[model samples]
Target: MKRPSAWHLVLAPLALLFALPLLWLLVSSVMTNAEINRFPPALIPSGIDLGGYRYVLGNALFPRWFVNSMIVSAVAVTANLAFGTLGGYAFARIRFAGSKLMLGMMLATMVIPFQLTMIPTFLVMKSLGLIDTLGALIIPSLVTPLAVFLFRQFFVSLPRELEEAAWIDGCGRLRILVSIVLPLARPALSTVAVLTFLSTWNDLTWPLIAINSDSNYTLQLGLTTFQGQHHTQWAAVMAGNVITVLPVLLGFLLAQKAFIRSLASTGLKG
Candidate 1:
């Protein structure tokens, strides 16, 4: 028989410690309200009860909120991939006047806290008449500095020989990028898509500030309606959270390998 490693023994408990809350949430979701509030709490439910899920799914407003979230996330992910990749490629391969200065400025903006710019962003949205609309969420999240940086680094690592050969064959920059660069950048693209979708889907604070109408609320924002000053529905909240988290969880699982590879390689050259 093989002996267990010391590292495994050390990591086993830490893994479980991190997973305990998710396990408790799953267990509690299937317990009755009374049982959930019982003394000492129950790690295991006596019987499975899906009343919480039933309540959340049965509500008409929940579906609308879910659809709204889907729209925002999809749009943001598409825009991020398209624009971020284009900008990154330009920064990596093109030698234009002020290109380095512009790239440096964009990177610097990433360090400034979003809180300091929140008010200015809100005013810009108000000026564009996007407030109280899903556009308010999607427009601002279209691209991010991190996504651009990731793509730039990945592009910079690719051999210039491929692009040079394409140029010799009379391929324009755009054509070369579309035919050669993008296909080779699947890992970085997948990483950017998954990250953007997760961030947009889980965002609540900005949505709360921008959207006032319940009809315009995203999934995260609508979930807050379940809470009241006098009473809170814990079971419903947990169920809603599970539903909201499912898509992001599935996305990560599908792209886990590519996502990790992209992140690991992002700083390799730039």
Candidate 2:
């Protein structure tokens, strides 16, 4: 193992500062719902209780919402990885008329806030009879412009020699992409996958607009049901919030190495 750099030492405190909130959430979740609602929030739990987890998992709609979120995130990640890579490769390696214009248009779409297109997007989904369905969530987020951009940037840094070598080996473009280019593009692929998963998992607005059925609700959307116009269950709400956040936290923890390596590799490529 290598020794820690001076910069690592200097940044240790900053890292902890950023992580404190997450640590608090994890700790608070184990506390009784009553403990969480108390004044001057309890940083430590008196006793670990599974009640919070029970409430969230046992809720009539939570399990369905969980499954919905998982499906959306999984499908979105797969689409982003496949289409984003192909799109990125085209933008980086392929030459054709209006290629630059098309990329620019895609980038322009990213600039337009989702809020501006929310109603129109919802209307489109409704017209397609996709309302109250997972298709509405999965289709719109299948491949985002940002994912394409990230992959394109990373792909540009790759040497053309590899693709050419694959061609010399009598591999077709699709075969080269699948067997040669993709294997080496793991860093960028991991980055795109992690980002797409996180975004689709946490997305609330589109799900709220697209899904009206309880069975199709996402974790974020289901969490909102814990709140009422007249009375809010703060404890259960916090519990749900904790439940909603756990998968993201666990996913990041398990994939942090790949994620950071991707960023570092991309930065060096730039």
Candidate 3:
């Protein structure tokens, strides 16, 4: 059998170090309120208690909040992928007057912090009469500069031979993009989808600003209110956290390989 490398000696402990907090959260979720509040903070429970899970499931608004988050994330991810692909393809393949200046200006937006733009964005949403609705959340995130930049980079890296051959066969740009290029662009697609999903799913600040109605609240915003509503219920709070984080963790674990591959292929990994 092959021996393990020396790096394993350092990494094994670090892995445990990172996992410990998640482990404690899971443990605490199953503990009773009394167990959680005990002196020294009980690390193990005497018996399983489903009360935390019960509280969350039985709350009508919590489930509604989960659904709201799913709706916004699904729409945002789909929109970003579709439009980012089109805009990126244009930048990568088509020659247009002022294209370089336009691309540079678009990329420049990425450096400006969200803090500076938040008020202006809020004013725009208010002007459109989208405030207090899910539309406010979906409109702004339809596409992002990073998505366009990544797609442009990946599309540029593709060998022109493929597109040229398709061109010889009388295939138009759209047909080539849909039928030829996209098939080989899975790594970039996966990276974009996973990133857009994570960002949209975990977003709280925007939802907090846009959604004033209880029915429109996303899970993160709802959870913030949940904690305030039931401050003493540590177990329930931990349970809510687990529920909130589980989807993102599972999603990243499933797509991490493709995500990493996309980074390397696009020259961003370096």
Candidate 4:
């Protein structure tokens, strides 16, 4: 075999460094509690055990948390995509007073840290009696500034001639948007959908603050139940992390092609 170049040698180590933690998590998930708590961690378990997974899957509440997370993610993603697409279309195709100011203000909200607004948001949710309900989590994420900005940029890059042609054929703005632009904007829509889903799926802090009852806990927040001040179940914690992350990882894997295509196409237009 030919000798690999120095660039290949450098990249080989970098790739291993990035993947090592994930590889360790996979191995540790199958290890015994004793092995996980060993003075020096076992690089490889002597025997594979399903105890950790069994514990997690057997917990009746785990299933509920998983389902709640899905509900919040699904509802939030749908709202974001629907509103984001329409908002993007209106901002891109329609011209109205203070449009530039409004766009700038929306984008500015994206830069504001969530921490700054958490108290106010929580108060509002409390006032609306949405606290401790999944609605608290889903409602806030329904209109993400980032999703709106991305969709607007994507919409602006689309050719206006297609829309004008549709209009000339007696199609109204709503019909033209539905039949023409949305179909052509699939890649961008998919990109937004996947990103929104992942964000809502992995969300922990907001859900933690908004959700007070164990019955409405999300998967990510449920992981905290595995930790204790006196002793931590490292193996179970790792297992929960693995389970919590698997859906998101799988979702990205499924949508990666559409995401990359959208990024490439959007970049070209920008």
TM-scores, all candidates, are 0.90, 0.83, 0.92, 0.89
Q: Which stretches of candidate 4 lie over 4 Å from their true place?
A: 38-41, 229-232, 257-270
- For TM-score, the strongest prediction is 3
Q: Stretches of candidate 2 above 4 Å error?
A: 1-20, 33-44, 229-235, 257-270
Q: What number of backbone clashes does candidate 1 have, counting pairs of residues 3 or more apart or in separate chains?
A: 0
**190: Cα error in model 2, Å:** 0.6
Using lDDT as the measure, the top candidate is: 3
Q: Which residue pairs of candidate 3 clash? A: none
TM-score of 3: 0.92
In candidate 1, stretches whose alpha carbon ends up further than 4 angstroms from where it belongs are 6-8, 229-232, 261-270
- lDDT, model 2: 0.83
lDDT of 1 by residue, 189-236 (tens): 888887788789999989988998999999988877755411356776
Q: Write the per-residue lDDT of candidate 2 for residues 80-137, one digit (tens) a residue.
A: 9999999998899888999999999998897798899999999999999999999999
- Per-residue error at 255 for model 1, in Å? 2.8
- Among all windows of ten consecutive residues in candidate 1, which has the lowest summed lDDT? 226-235
* lDDT ranking, high to low: 3, 1, 4, 2
Q: What TM-score should be assigned to candidate 1?
A: 0.90
Writing each residue's lDDT as its tens digit, candidate 3 over 1-270 gives 988899998999999999999999898889999987878877779998989989987888888988989999999999988998988888999899999998999999988999999999999999999999999999999999988988898899999998998899899989988999899988788888887898999998999999998888999999999999988998998889888998888876787787566556547542
Which 10 consecutive positions of candidate 3 have the poorest summed lDDT?
Answer: 261-270
